[model samples]
Target chain A: MGEFEIFGMPVSLGTMIFQAVIFTALIWILKQKFLSKLVGAMESRRESIDNQLNLAETYKHEAEEELLKQREMTEKATQEAKQIIAKAREEANIIVKAARKEAFTIRTEAYENERRALKGRGAS
Target chain B: MHATRPLVQIFGLTFDLSIIITSTIAALVVLVFAYACTRHITAKKPGKMQNLLEWVIEFVQNIMVNSMGRKDNLFILAGGVGLILYLFIANIMGVPFSFIAGADHATWWKSPTADAHVTMTLAIMMIVYTHFIHIRLHGLKNYFLSFFKPFKALFAINILEQFCTTLTLGLRLFGNIYAGEVMLGILAAAAMKGFQSGIFIGIGSSMLAAIPMMIWQVFCLFIGAIQAYIFVTLFMVYIGQRVNEATT
Candidate 1:
């Protein structure tokens, strides 16, 4: 080692170089094999989570819109049903009034004709 | 203690074989651990190892984001994970057992991080990489101008600070791990001395030393993890300084 010493410890260039190489190799191998895989997995998982969240948000919005449309349709149908019932009641009242007037007229005419016939027989 | 490590001359450079071996062992252990923790990684249903690995990655991500403000730097994130894993594993490698062999009692096994060479090399590598990143991010001219930032009078201080950063970053880890191992060695020697003196005294003193040793080992584990976190965090902070300097 040619008497190289630092702080009472022998310093060797070979050992330093060897260790540096080992450390570099360690970093390269780990980066290539393990860290990349883990990071990739994490990234994909995050992307999927984001995608699912976005999908849920859109679905919720669509469901709300559909519920609103169904409510409006039900309201319109109820209003139309009320209008039809009111028109049917008005038509039934008019028909019953006309029928009662016609029956009263017919009874009056029959009574008058019978009285006139009795008077003629007495005169004869 | 041996004055020199077992040296193997190769191509005019003297290599410390023990550091090489222990470091290789530490590196292999890290590799195996990484594989074990990541073998069955599932995005949906993660296993225990997967969960731990994910947690570590997330932790590193949080550190980077905290420092750099959500900048997308995958390379740095990967390096951060590698750094923390390797450092934590290497720092604790000497806690369980140490191996010394031959007549000179050459150390065959220990934490590679306990040695100044490995730690300094790591520190240098990180600093150099940081500079490279700085240059790549802000151009060479900007990086050069950064040394004189806010005024021209502080250039020397800025230059000195870089050296200080490297030294402190390396030596802090070395100092902690080395102290830990030195104390462990002392305790082990005391225990051995107890066993050598007599059976009853050996049992008593050995038991006495065992408590401290166990406690030190646990403390070393905590130190290892903390040091790893600090090292990686500081490295990120340095990178963050470079990356966010333009914006700030």
Candidate 2:
């Protein structure tokens, strides 16, 4: 190792060994302090993003469900309104029919009494 | 014409102080960047530094996944990020300010990766780590058998490939960075010579030198970034070969 020279630069075995050690220490320090934290931060960011997406999905699903429920209620109210209108129409028809029958009976009774009085006056 | 470096001897070993100092500066710069980036990490709203740090991390992860088809190994992911950060910072550290001092013209500051020893050290470390992982993943017997592969005649060739990978990985980075610096130095020297010539020639020649210098500086920055990327990509590729081959 002593007489090794290339391009006027002496290649030192000592320096090589020493630098390897230095590089190892550097890797260890960087792994412990910098890399781990950065990875952790990245992971946490990913987790947060995922959580937010999930929450949004849940909200969307809930909104859809609520919309469905509102539509069903509106449909139910419409059906009820139709049923009420139908029932009122039926009641009105029944009342009109009964009033017409009563009016007819009263007219027949009046006509019968008038005939009976004419016949009795003729007999007298 | 080769530059001289200040040397110190301790315990029968020669240590280059310049390389040590420059490398330490590079390491310190990387550490400071890491610290500042991680000081107040936030998941919801990351600051610029944190964003930068995460970008590098994800970038490295993407490289690994693209190459290795796996990213469950957090240790390797972090290692990749660290390697890139160190190499990039070291490769570009000397670009703006390279200090050659004293009568010896000893380089007080320069890119540590410009030195073969530093790059070789990293390459060796990374290669050794890959082999370790290969062995750990496939046991010693399987790892040894890997050399013989589909054809037993290719044993020697496989063994040679390991050496080649290491050599190329280290040398590629060293060559690019060193050549850039050398060219920059030549331009600077020309500028200095031009400055000493005469009034008009000095200004004219120096201006001529400055254009290339500026252009080379930008080129060096581009090369530094590219070299760092290449080193890490190759590293992941090597590791991927080691790790993925076991399953198949």
By lDDT, the best candidate is 2
Query: What digit string (tens of lDDT, one per residue) describes model 1 on residues B52-124?
Result: 8888989999999899887367889889999998999999999999988888788878999999889999999
- Fnat of each prediction? 0.74, 0.69
- Model 1 regions lying over 4 Å from their true place: A6-9, A60-124, B1-4
Docking class of 1: acceptable
The DockQ for candidate 2, computed on C-alphas, is 0.42
Which residue pairs come into collision in candidate 2? none
DockQ of each: 0.44, 0.42
Work out candidate 1's RMSD over C-alphas. 6.7
| CAPRI-style docking class of model 2 based on DockQ | acceptable
Q: TM per model?
A: 0.81, 0.84
**Per-residue C-alpha lDDT of model 1 across residues A1-124, encoded as one tens digit per residue:** 5337876766778888899998899889888887888888777777888898999999999999999999999999999999998999898889888888888888888888888889889999
Per residue, candidate 2 scores C-alpha lDDT tens digits across A4-121 of 7877756677778778877888889999878887898898899999999999999999999999999999999999999999999999999999999999999999999999999999
